[model samples]
Target chain A: MREVEPKLLKPLVAGFQLEKTLTKYIVSQHNFLYCQKAADLDASVGKTTFTLLRQINELQKILNQKIMLYRDRFSEADVYAVYCEHPDYEGLNDGTFVDRIEDMCELSTKCAIKEWNKSQIRNEAKQACFLFRERRKWLEIYKTIHNETKTVWLAQRHH
Target chain B: MSMPTIPPEPHRPNRKEVIIDLLESIALEEIALSHILNAESEKIQAFVGECLNFPTKPSSKEIIKFNKGVTQLLESVVMKEWILLRKLENVLDFEDDCEPHHKKCESRCHCSPCHSCHFPVCKCRCSHKKHKDHDCYPGK
Candidate 1:
């Protein structure tokens, strides 16, 4: 099922080329009703979906490359002008992006640290900020806990 | 009368060294984290895309199978993310958690390219280190 590529199904149905996996998957669609030509493919729902996915992926890749080229032709000022034009981008604050996270420190400590450990190369500045922020948060919380408990604990020990 | 002498203390780094060590550790941790997040995101995205494919109008049974695949992937992904979060928490030790906070200007730091802690020139021992005075070569 995972191996099925709808693009290859066209050739298989046309009797042009017979790949075993494509034939098996396509035939499984509807009792192996053979496609007369590429035009006949529309009637088969399964085959059409796979073909469209492949087509869309190719188009997206090409479009992305062209976009990069387009940006390359423009100056930084031109790019900034386009960036500022968007209504949603009020300014480049943290609010400019969504903050789905609750605790930045917790996210940094657990998931980020594990990922960082596994990574072969690193971006030091980014890492430094992450680490510093996590520590800052910890210190903030630790102070709060320390102040609340210090008097009670000291009294109990004296008694 | 001569006062009793106390033995000289062993070499110990100051607050500035402590800050540098922590910063370096943290930066390294973040780099590792970014990599994992990227890898997991890619994996989950691919799974969702696969689920979006429905060849011909799917029969009830086929729909069920498709939904099952998606549900399984989501469940696993959720667990993975949760596990990663927990791992991050553990990595940041709460033990001996306190450090003496020194108010220093972090402004000049983002100013320099060589990234050799351009925070204010302190009276710390690190000032004596040769690299501090010289122009640092960029790469290792």
Candidate 2:
């Protein structure tokens, strides 16, 4: 069996298109579901959430272009064939490159969602506080009215 | 059929519950990724070891080239990770908290970007002695 060519391996150094991986694993698989759920629950938050998602997507695209440009400065193939030249290369169990691209992307969304949830909670708490204050004021007014009516009824009974 | 009584209000999902779910998922992902990165690094290291271990040693030039390739691979990995981490931090609004300290600046200190460390300049006016010479002093 021909040993794994170093030339082929060299491409892998900077080769795996992370943008594509993130887009595939994150934007396509994860974000769509989250967006749908967020929108279903709340419209305003859903709009902001979509905006954040767009920013992330744009960031990925810009970085992808930058990395590609930087990578272009280097030659594609070089004389690094020593690994393949080893006699026992065939016996060597070169483990598979398990790209944890999904996990990383998932973490990104996890963080983004967490922030959104925090802001949502904050807004909810604020609104709840306002309602509580309003209700308290009404309760005080009702109590005063009840006290006046009771006093008038007692005087009438005494008379 | 007899007239039914008024139904109770539908249960609305609590914001805290959703936040808790998000936090849990984030924690789980971090733990999984930590292990995954370590495992992947080991695999790469093993490959590099095999490349170096030879019956008849190759020329110094070839060895250097192989090492260079390995370094480049590792560099790419680190860069990718850094990018993702920074992006994550940005998403979470944790950019103000610089690394090493990672503590919020209590005093009126502005965190300027230091080109050397790529981390923010730690002029947090904290107890940590100011390294004026190098704005991004990484060490304690």
Candidate 3:
């Protein structure tokens, strides 16, 4: 049997690592925008929401471009595996996976905003404060995922 | 004669510029995530295939099929995220009639001729032309 050459393995591993990084980055961004949008909605109705939503939209565009770039860099096979292993993938149909996350992220953002508004009107300072802190938590999770995946990639390469 | 004092301009940040910066950061994150996911999956599959080969080597076709399933799963996830990002972009278009600034910027500003001029300087030049206001390069 012919051995799988180290040369072939190197690129393959590298490609997968790239895909993982892209996915986590995107998810984190989505979460960040979601929280920001929520906070904006809670604070005011018109320009603030519009501004945050607009920012979210812009982030989405960048995300799209990055996705295309990564797709071009790696093979379909590499992309697929990453999707399968993602925690968010569970209970999501393959066709609707992206839409689901996008929708949920947007909805969550709006919800956060609504909650913020409610707390403000009711003067529930603690709840309002929690919303801000929760968003930061999501960001931290994103960073953790990114760091762990990077460490894994390094280990594979060296080993 | 005493000179009249002029009030400083308000320090409001441009909404569009803020959006662009946030988007760039998100895009970078997406690239990093994809890189890690793809690499990890490949590593796992390779290790599994090697282990299975201990007693009797699996046929190339069998290994390929197994690998294909794994790859498909990952691709689907990535695609889903891509679609979400696209939808968000669509929703965020503030100036409904305006062309996406990024696309226009890439073409008109990044080229060698435009590079000679700084971004704001080039944008000022482009805005004077027949181009739509949205398409005009953002002035620094």
Candidate topping lDDT: 3
Q: Comparing chain B with the reference, what is the TM-score for each candidate?
A: 0.33, 0.33, 0.35
List DockQ for all candidates: 0.01, 0.01, 0.06
Clash count for candidate 3 is: 38
Q: Higher lDDT: candidate 2 or 3?
A: 3
> iRMS for model 2?
21.2
The whole-model C-alpha lDDT of candidate 2 against the native structure comes to 0.36
Tens-digit per-residue lDDT, A50-138, candidate 3: 33233333333443354454344444434433433443432222323244234433444445355554433233223322432343343
Fold similarity of candidate 1's chain A to the true chain A, as a TM-score: 0.26
Q: What is the lDDT of residue A48 in candidate 2?
A: 33
lDDT of each: 0.31, 0.36, 0.39
- Of the pair 1 and 3, which is ahead by TM-score? 3
Q: Lowest lDDT 10-mer window, candidate 1 chain A?
A: A11-20
Question: What's the DockQ of model 1?
Answer: 0.01
Candidate 3 at residue B14, lDDT?
69
Model 1: per-residue Cα lDDT over B1-140, one tens digit each: 99998778797666445434543453344334334434443443333333333335445454445434433443443344344334323332321122111233333332222224433333222434544564332221
On a 0 to 100 scale, what is the lDDT of residue B135 in model 2? 49
Query: Chain A vs. true chain A, TM-score per candidate?
Result: 0.26, 0.27, 0.33
Instruction: Write down the TM-score of every candidate.
Output: 0.21, 0.21, 0.24
How does chain A of candidate 3 score by TM-score against the true chain A? 0.33
Share of the reference A-B contacts seen in candidate 3? 0.13
Clashing pairs in 2: none
